[model samples]
Target: MAVLALDPHIAPPAIVLQVADRERPAAGGGRLLPSGFLSTSGSQIVDAGGRSVRIASIGWNGTDSPPGAVLAGLWQVSYRTVLDAIVAGGFNTVRIPWTDAGLDVPLNGYNDRLGWIHTSLNWDLVADPAPDANGRYRYVTTLQLFEKVVSYAGQIGLKVIFDHHTNEGTEQKNGLWFDLGPGSAGRDGGVKGRVTAETFKQNWVRIARTFAGNPTVIGFDLHNEPNGEKGLITWGGGGPTDIKAMCETVGAAIQSVNRDALIICPGPFFYAPPPAASGMDPGFATPSGNLTAAGTNPVKLPIANKLVYTVHEYPDEVSDIARFDLAQSGAAYVDRMNRGWGYLVRDNIAPVWIGEMGSSLRTQADRDWAATLIGYMSGDYGNQGGPTFGPGQQPISGSWWLIGPSNDPPYGIQTEWGIGNFRSEQRDITDRMLMR
Candidate 1:
């Protein structure tokens, strides 16, 4: 791979938000009553007057690694280029994915005096206890890079959501998530492994505590995409992993440390399935007899008010949108979401956000599907009473397109798979909808 530029640019001015205790207007009510700064064992958010901000955001894993690409140095000059483009395109938030282990080198772009930078540079070359020894456990680079990114986004009015793509390893299948334990079940299972479950709660605590006071951090995603047989069931138990239960556990961990930050938890199948056990994977449900062990226990945590259910709608197999040529009409697009997209977000009461969407799909059919899906979720989801935690309760709070070097020309600048085409095109579409 070619080495891109890696020179630290001077940091921009930071936003100085007033911290106070005041009641902000709710979506549609008298208002959420006044309260003090949101506090937790790990950290605190909210101003002295009690106004909390939600992260209406986007996801970009650049400045890090792609499935088949080499690791880019954190200070790579393109990091700034990509970030500048994203901000210029009008996105005010970014979900940064980093390996759980840590980074081995120092990012050299900003003035070395940034607080997050100085505090995060420990020079520890270990991926122990959690990520093992492979390059996966490294959070050193993630810590430095994300802090800078988050700080920068704050300067530009964007929020930040930190996500852990995997623990550590050389290769991954289809760019999935980290499982809890060992073997195929844990590695490529996409949060199906025990290692994930084992370490997740603690991870939340650490992360929540780190950004406790910064409202610019929208929240933390416990895990990316929960999948596989051993993965989370809707409940908690030995039967399999229970995403609902995982939410409770991880949510509590975050709440324990910083009660004010929001918690965004993706549904099973990465938002690919509905509540019905039929469309869902057998493993995601508890074992036939372990009903009690399933994660059915009610979640009674304080952060429940701030909980947001996350799911994705990519156009791979199973998406009804892909079955027909959707590039044709508005009605077809609406129909696809009503059938497939609607099913995913309608069941939950908490706000629903399309955490990940956009495909490297290659066809007019695919592109049409993308346009419709993006339109439906960002526009229609709000029209329909999907789920929302904040005042408006809009079902589709946010959406982002996946990007990589794979997105080269021709289709360039218009689609995620074709590079240049997607950035400009997605930005145009997104800007029209979001107005950021």
Candidate 2:
């Protein structure tokens, strides 16, 4: 219907660009690109045509988890193959977790690992990785690598949600949306990885601009698992550390550039059931994945129906999952779910996406927790208002924690570092969960 501008200066890798420029469809003269532009409609995320779009995704982690600072499985598997596995696994989207660690590594560029490819797998990732004759390097920068991944995924009919997992390649060394070095948290410092609020927003803006109007790049999971000792990542405090404030600020900035991108703001770790009345307070730490403040102070974005609140539920040994006895559907558990972020869905406030959820499934408790979570989230109990989308809307959507080779139970979707074989045991759970 309407024209959307994908980055005019830069485009997907040459090989995939041909695929993206295929018979794009919308209406009238036809869409310049795929018609995946998304927006919110009363707690539902809908595609350009206004049909509900469920984000059934699988996380392809490692870029932000550290050690490699690149997408995992590339050491042995091509990203295309990985995408094939994801599609076969029945996921419509891929949650690409990344960091700012390499973004400024290049002297004149962002992300030293530009247009990256495994040297063994593709010619693009040359051993030297240095630009040659026409200032064009045989190797791609990491950002370019990311772009190429998105381009190909879109070609094969998959959406992507870029999750800013950590400040650096390592992890969330600090709870805030920043990483600090010995000196300041204000400027760029790779030594200790300085990522201030300002820099965080700046990095996000850069990313948003990079993929501004590409419909394949559906949403932005702003940050992952906001938690800290005292109250470093509390929301609605109206202060800098307030995660709600951060989401609003960053989301506004993103919509400013790409108004169509869905801004996913997850619940920070500070769970507590909200007070029944204004007189009551849910106190500090409870079992729920916290978004208590938002029960009153919702994340207001520059664009309406574009804010989707999210949560990462591990249920066992993660956060206060045990504290609430969530596996058994305890009262405390349901309450926390409501006050935390569930109300957003039930009250028709905003859509809620479980940004992350996984387990080793080693213990009976683990399996139970996972079952309970997906069941509640999937509207198995539509009468209780656990989570239920509107008519023509998809079931409460989410991404399986990962297609992994991780040690933290790894969200194991594949066996050999995510390249060997499918971890069907784990996928059995996901197949039931996401393949609705």
Q: Evaluate all candidate structures by whole-model CA lDDT and list the values in order.
A: 0.44, 0.64
Residue 144 miss distance in model 2 (angstroms): 1.2
Superposed Cα deviation of residue 348, candidate 1 (Å): 7.9
lDDT: which candidate is best?
Answer: 2
Model 2 gets an lDDT of 0.64
Encode model 1's per-residue lDDT on 32-113: one tens digit a residue: 2122232221111233444432333446653334222212222232344344444444454567765544333333223322
**After aligning candidate 2 to the native by TM-score, how far in Å is the CA of 108 from where it should be?**
18
Per-residue error (Å), model 1, residue 371: 3.4
The parts of candidate 2 lying over 4 Å away from their true place are: 1-34, 66-68, 104-118, 127-138, 180-193, 271-281, 284-288, 317-332, 383-385, 417-420
lDDT of 2 by residue, 195-284 (tens): 677787888899899998788898899988776343455556566766777789999998888887889987766544433332224564
Give the Å error, residue 279, model 1.
11
